[model samples]
Target chain A: PAPDSAAQGLALARNGQLTKPPGALGRLEDLAIWLAGWQGREKPQASAPQVVIFAANHGIAARGVSAFPPQVTAQMVANFRHGGAAINQLSRTFGASLGVHALDLDQPTADFTQGPAMTEAEVVSALATGWNAVDPEADLLVTGEMGIGNTTSAAAIAAALLGGNAQDWVGRGTGVDDHGLARKAETVRAGLVAHADALHDPLEVLRRLGGREIAAMTGAIARARMERVAVVLDGFICCAAALVLQRLHEGALDHCIAGHVSAEAGHGRLLAALGKDPLLALGLRLGEGSGAALALGVVQGAIACHSGMATFAEAGVSGA
Target chain B: PAPDSAAQGLALARNGQLTKPPGALGRLEDLAIWLAGWQGREKPQASAPQVVIFAANHGIAARGVSAFPPQVTAQMVANFRHGGAAINQLSRTFGASLGVHALDLDQPTADFTQGPAMTEAEVVSALATGWNAVDPEADLLVTGEMGIGNTTSAAAIAAALLGGNAQDWVGRGTGVDDHGLARKAETVRAGLVAHADALHDPLEVLRRLGGREIAAMTGAIARARMERVAVVLDGFICCAAALVLQRLHEGALDHCIAGHVSAEAGHGRLLAALGKDPLLALGLRLGEGSGAALALGVVQGAIACHSGMATFAEAGVSGA
Candidate 1:
């Protein structure tokens, strides 16, 4: 949905009269006006935020492209279930409901370097799974992912979609050593070469080089826009999914907010391509929706200031 | 008191056992370690946060340096009390206790361009008042300020302490016009010249040019460190206060975190001089503690990740 320009104008006018100097709130005022436009209300309400963590295992893990073993994906999922992961704690802190979904828990994708990561049918199924994960009742939706060697898949997809070199796209996933980074880069380069012809199609790119979690996140973002729910994109992998979604569906990112700039090498470039500014930059690289959850507070702050703060007239104060 | 190096080491060792890759959490892990050292606990808690907003009127308002009038200071203070200000909403969202203190409500300082801003006795009284504002039981302390034309005062003080020219230090406060900005710069330059001889002394510099809120914030930061409470310094004016506190008492910044790099011109230099990395960089220039209140969430997220996350052994996951 397009943002309501009328409401945005009203919000901007109100901001100017809010007893502070013009633009004193800086980017915060901009965020509030953006939220007002999306919510289609002069005073938008940010409540009942929900975060979903899509967990999957990547076939690229077998290529020694990640520092942690592929089995850690399931282990971290269990950790999330037991409320022992960073995302779990963050969700609790932000008062958001946490959902952990193993989109391909029992079925890992084929190694992208060897062939396609997932079949077209599997990609469609994963997208459906992600689409179904969006809750109708939630006002805000945040997307996070848990997958080992997924960064390698994300790099290939990003390289194909954003027209970047594999080496430039690749980063040390899970803090890999030099050898592991080299292997990861080589694997991503090989996958891009294998899928070069089909890379023009967003779904083909996902099927050929992206993991189930990325596909699911893409679906989640698309569905969030359809449902008029605000989306918060997490980090590098998540932004890669958003890139694919934005390519497939124009204006998909209108409902989305980039949560943070991840420590990953290509995350900043990905955010720039997507045309979104992150709210926080604490050098966070954790990808279990932790950054998204942390950003909920900032989003809420923007909403609170936009809707709840008194205007100059209401406060009987002079304007700038 | 110095940070507990033993606790920091223990926290670092524990971070290695977390289920994620080593350093995957990035600066969040570092923030947790810093909190551990300050809290003197391997698992530092970020509960019971408090934000104190020091409200006063700056003498430099007479120079027409600010976009907003001096009367807006007391009006915004009323807004804070009525829960209508940005800081109030942020405090409510973050669940931090809000303290609004009118340090010199009945006593506006003199124009520093012509003469000293405050008397030695008034500065001493303001410092003690700020000292008394600290809550003994609070775990985290955030300092914010509200004073019209305070930015000009902050610029003068920063130029004097950090040894920079007024052109490098001056910024448009509350979205000033180009003419107002030029006037502000000229006023700051004149004040710096007037107080050049006494600028070597930190307290004398504060007395000659700094607003009461700055003095109070300096005192609050010192007192918070003495009470072993972590301080989150908001924006440029607050950073100026921190500069004075650091100069007056060495190691005062050990308990402080730069909340965000303000849009003010000299804030980056100020943070660099203090050797602090801000948690957020949202281009916030709103005073009255809004940035610091937003940062409480980030600080809490770090603490939550540190203490609540499951170790590799505990989660039955293999290490990288």
Candidate 2:
């Protein structure tokens, strides 16, 4: 669907709901109603909201963009398995099923070693692997990426795909200081220059500098389109994946909803290019689907308002 | 606690968690961690989050600051009983038990009459009623008010408590137009003049113009202080009640957690007087404990992080 057509659906959902007057439900109500129209139903239902965690090692970690060592990636994955990560807590809270996929981007299989980011083919395959892991019947999919120093990867990808200086879109990831950020920015710039021609293609750029997790998220978004599953994006990193998918298929964006805006610099540019608004702004920079998880309640509130709120006719109240 | 004291607790919660590094959980994680310390427990628990709704008639409703007629106050109360209002939906979704109480201020409780704005005796009675309504032991209590033309009442209370201009604090409640707003402002000014002597005695002022609900909420906040329960505040209106409680018992401020900052102009003054910072700012003006309901999850998240997240000691992760 083009932007106009998708917006029309949103408008219809906003108007025809059986609840309170138009826009009474606020933004969440708007989303639920929009999703209802997208699903072509009056009572849009979400049984299982799936959160896909894409994990890959970033080569830029060597540039000291992150306070923790790159080994934290694999370690966090193990932690995820043990259900100790933030995402794990959010998954339980939101009742969203969590799927953790490791993108073996030629880094250490069990520890950490630096290498070129996953090849383009590897990126696509890793995404496919994660996307395939989802039950196609899942009501909605929220994509989150987990990779040490991946902020550097995201900045490079955004610069190449959206056309900008890498330094502007980049920010301190994992609490790196000013000097560390400078080095990280320089490293990202070099990666962009080295892969400029390949950067002409979003997939090519992702493969060149994006970690396995990002590629996996791109694949997940693509698969979501194929399966007609709506994708709720978490912060700047995941939006990078959505941008790649938008290039592949403009209609793919119809399935995307930005959960919240990040303090990260590039997120605004990506959101603008995609022509979408981030629903919440709490100055969150942490990834791992925490923002997306918070947005789930908003979405749920929307659904409840649309499905449960009494209209003027039903509640016998006057409407403006 | 001072800002730095709260910040220290946040720093602890941000760090020493098993999954992510310090600041990895973002602002929410820091908040949750801070709340745990307030509870005096490493892991805080929130089994029952309570929202007490106070319904009263405002003297300003006579001035016409609202699109809806004042009769809508009792109508909304009926709607609430039937569980058809937005607040009803929110309390249900957030799993926070809700209590609605009517404070009688010598106004006609007759079928057509709006309500009793409190009298000092009525204020004391309403607070007593509200105090008795809650569990002797509860984790958190949220105080919210519902009334037509309540923003005018709130602005007046804020002005009286904080010594600000009523016009400066007043806003368009329920969508009043410019002419209606001017009338509303005039109404606030007239009410201020009419009640100046009574307002000089805060309790007397509350009895004169504060609706039964505002009086009840003030009592509930005072009760929360006595019971040592955390009180989550919504917006300007709620903050006005909080200010009264703060005036009545200075320690009452300790139990409050500013839930969300309102787009309401007076909220800034009210929050400043209370010496609190709101956790979220979503441009919300819907006053049915909607802001507090949203904050419920954050409070729960804070308690959960303290209780559930594995410490570095437990997970055997290296400290920074």
Candidate 3:
């Protein structure tokens, strides 16, 4: 079931009686009410949060579409294991268990400019890999990704799914120079042109233009909804995967929260399409689930304020 | 001294080698550099954070200037004492020591519409009280306030300091109805008009048209700068206090960060006057340092990413 409106109302009423003015907590109050509704209780607790980083290599790197080489993808996975990556430090700081899934780092996707990024069967397998990675015991889940040149694939997928020019969606992934950025934009354009027939079907779009990590993230989001776990989405790549999931399941975004707005070009349009407002907008463009991991503390803080705060009646404080 | 430009440049250079693209971390990188410069160290740590909630009563409440009665101010102070207020909960969540100081809760300031909010001597004493509240051992300080109808006082002070009409500065504080908002606006206009002779001097403006808590907050900001402590400023009321400090001392904002943009009407103009970009934009209007406390984690995350995470060269990962 969706969040319970009755619990939300009760929480809202309780907030009015708290020591502060009505709606003074602003989005924190709304967050508390939403958590109450989602938890089906007057007070919700965001305990045992988990973060998963889906990583894979993109074949578009062969075309010099990204500033960083594809080998960095495998290297970053090792960094995650060694607790040296930004996501690792963030997960530890925010008290979330970090899970790094290197889904096909050894097998780069086919260059989508000329052909489908992955076979249909590979996409399904990747989705299942993401779906099965969810921990039912987690109170909250955050989705993140790490793949060199995956931004090109994400941009291609976004352009096809969102119906805009490739130039509008393409950005300087990994601080690519002007030439590399132009090449990436052209690569997305060519991929979209090649997959025009498949663009209408979300699944076909994922197989043709999206990388395995994105497909996996979509599956992860779907599974999180099915398991009734709240998901905090990272930046553009994760949001692109969410777009695919939202298209397939109309209410898929009901369980998700945008953690931060990415510095990518099309992210604003993508977020608008999903009707989601991000909590933080610090211009984060890192893709290793860093943005989402940074948001875990905020979600926890919101839940703590909801579950642990004292009401006016309880605190012997006068109401407004 | 101001933030060390050399340290900031060094940190910026270091960020480029941290596996992600240059400027990929966005505001987080900037935060790291800012902290580095402020602390005069290449790596900074937000180790000990302190939050002070200055509570007082507003005489303007008798004129129907607020939704809540004046007694709620004293009642909320008791709530803070018992660790039941939102600021208390946020303080605990962010690992900050919470201090609630009721400078003169039983004695409401004189209604500014009729006369000065406080005698000049009382303003100086309150400023000293706020100045002495700073913990020199603390790494971060957060300022918050609790006073009914204080928004009216804040709006009036902002109108005088920033050169605006009362209607532009007035907002529906504490969920005031349209009639109450209109009354509050009128009250500010009256107060500003009454204090027109003192409007040119920032301290005179605070004394004539601002509440005791606002005066104390101004002192706190000034003291934080002197103590070299980083301050996370709360919503509109706190920003109003900061404007006074900034006018009195040009570098008062050097140690401050706007925690969030309040829902108040004139807060945008106030923040613009100070040239501040708030970290959180959840429309929080709660005054008791709740927004600043909530921002502690984000600032910490930025610092951690700067100090703890590995560089691409160290991790054998290719840089953008």
Candidate 4:
């Protein structure tokens, strides 16, 4: 669904009436306008933001592609639930609600290097899990992931969808050394070769090469568009999930904004591919919605200024 | 005085024990460490941040350099006092204390193109006003300005210190047209020529070519270092203020970080000369402490994560 054009038009006019120069706020002016359009209100608000975390185990962990074992996925989920993780601290700092959903952490997806990562039914179920996780009442949404070896899956998906080589999409995940990075790249290459036929269809590509958490992020983002909740996409794996949706539907990610470009090398490339102008670039790489939650402050600040500031006439200030 | 290196070392050790992988948080990790050092605590806090706005009139407005008239500076300061400006909204959003100071708004500085912008006594008083504006109880600080035609003054100062031509440092401030831009460049050149003899000393350069608000920002930043409060520098004029201190004393801006790289053309060049990596780059050009106030969220988030997250052993999460 397209955003309300009337609200956007009204916001544009209001931006010009503010005390500063026409575009003095720069991207923040655009952010307020974008929020107004999505929320269907000339005055947008960012009071209620939601952050959801999807956790799953990828079978690719057996390939020694990740520094930590797959069980760490379940462990981190426990940490998130107990409010002991970085995302939890960020959520608390921003007053954002944090939701953690673990998708069959004990049952890992099939290794994509050997065969399809998930059957069509399995992929559909994971997508539904993600879609159902979104809160319709949330004015803003951010989706994050927790899956060991998932970077390898995201790399394979990018290689399939964006036509990049495995090395181009792969980066060190969870502090992997040089040899591990090389091995991860090779693993992605093998997965791409195995899933070559399914690359024709974006959903099929997701089913064959995407992990459950990544697919869940895809579903959640798609659901955000339906619910009229603006989304802030986080890091590399989240962008890979958005890629599947961007390829699946024309203008699918229009309601979404790149929260921040991470330190992961592939993230910049993925942001470029997604046609997203990222909001923040603090060299952050932590995935569990930390970057997006941090950016919630910026999004909130933009809306606050848009709604809270007085126009030139109201302030009795002269304009150019 | 330098930051507490002992606290920084302890904070570094604590960072490695957090649940996430080593350096997974990227620049945020460094921010946390920096905060810890400045605050002299292993567990840094961002509970209170102060934003100070200095307003003045520049005589160069008579040269038709800015889009708005000179009177608009006083008008905007009144708006700020009434809590009707963008900075007011941002301050409310981040819970920062805002102090507005109008430095002799009725008296515009002398035109620098003909002679020094301010007498030595006037410049010293302006700096002292900035120095006295800071709140010692605040944990973080941001300095902003409201002065029409001040960008022209900042450009002349940048060209003087950084060895650039007037055209290289001049930009379309407050949305000037091409003709106004050319006029601004010529005005900056004239100011530089008029003040050539006094450019040998940093304070003399500030007195001869800098506006009151710009000098105020310089004094405020230096006061922040003395108080051991971490500073986040704003846009082009603010950087030009910082440059004076950076050249006057070695490592003068060691306690400061560039808040955001603004859309003003000279801001990026000024940031590069200072060797300070900016936190946000949303192309913001509004100079009313808006960029640095927006960045307060990121700094708060970094410290929150650093102090709030549980250690790997405490969370029972697997480590690499």
Mind giving the per-residue lDDT tens digits that candidate 2 earns over A1-320?
32235544654654553333344344655576567755556656555789878787866676677877877777777777788777777767667899888777346221112334664466667767866866677777888877888887788778878887768878876677888888777877787767766777877767776767777787787777677677788888898877887777676788778887877777877888888887666667778877777777666655655556665556666543
Among the numbered candidates, top TM-score falls to 4
Q: Which lDDT value does model 1 have at B121?
A: 92
Clash number for candidate 1: 0
Could you give candidate 1's per-residue lDDT for residues A1-320 as a string of tens digits?
A: 67889998998888877756677777888888887887777887766889999999888889898888888899889999998899988888888999989976778899887889888889999898889999977868998999988999998989999897888988886788889889988998899889888888988998899999999999998888877788888999999898997888777798888888889988989899899988877778879988888988888887788778888888877777
User: What are the DockQ scores of the candidates, in order?
Assistant: 0.75, 0.36, 0.73, 0.84
Pairs that clash in candidate 2: B32-B302, B43-B306, B43-B307, B54-B213, B55-B213, B56-B212, B118-B207
Q: In model 1, which residue pairs have backbone atoms overlapping below 3 Å? A: none
Per-residue lDDT tens digits of candidate 4, residues A1-320? 89999999999999889988889999999999999999999999998899999999988899999999888999999999999999999998888999999998989999888888898889999999999999999989999999999888888888899997899999987778999999999999898888777887899888889889999999999999998999999999999999999998879999999999988879999989899988988878789988888899999999989999999999999999
* C-alpha lDDT (0 to 100) for residue A222 of candidate 1: 87
Judged by lDDT, which candidate is best?
A: 4
Model 1 per-residue lDDT tens digits across residues B30-88? 88898888888899987789999999987779889988888888888888899888888
Candidate lDDT values, in order: 0.86, 0.69, 0.85, 0.92
Better candidate by lDDT, 1 or 4: 4
Q: Residue A156 in candidate 2 has what lDDT?
A: 76
Model number with the top DockQ: 4
All models, RMSD in angstroms: 1.5, 4.0, 1.7, 1.1
Docking class of 1: medium
Q: For all candidates listed, what's the TM-score of chain B alone?
A: 0.97, 0.87, 0.97, 0.99
Please, what are the lDDT tens digits per residue for candidate 3 over residues A243-306?
9987777887898888888888778788888899988888888888888888887887787777
**Candidate 3: tens digits of C-alpha lDDT, residues B18-84:** 7667788788888888887877678877757999989888888899988888888888888889888
Clashes of each: 0, 7, 0, 0
lDDT of 2 at A139: 74
Q: Give the candidate order by descending TM-score.
A: 4, 1, 3, 2
> What TM-score against the true fold does each predicted structure earn?
0.97, 0.89, 0.97, 0.98
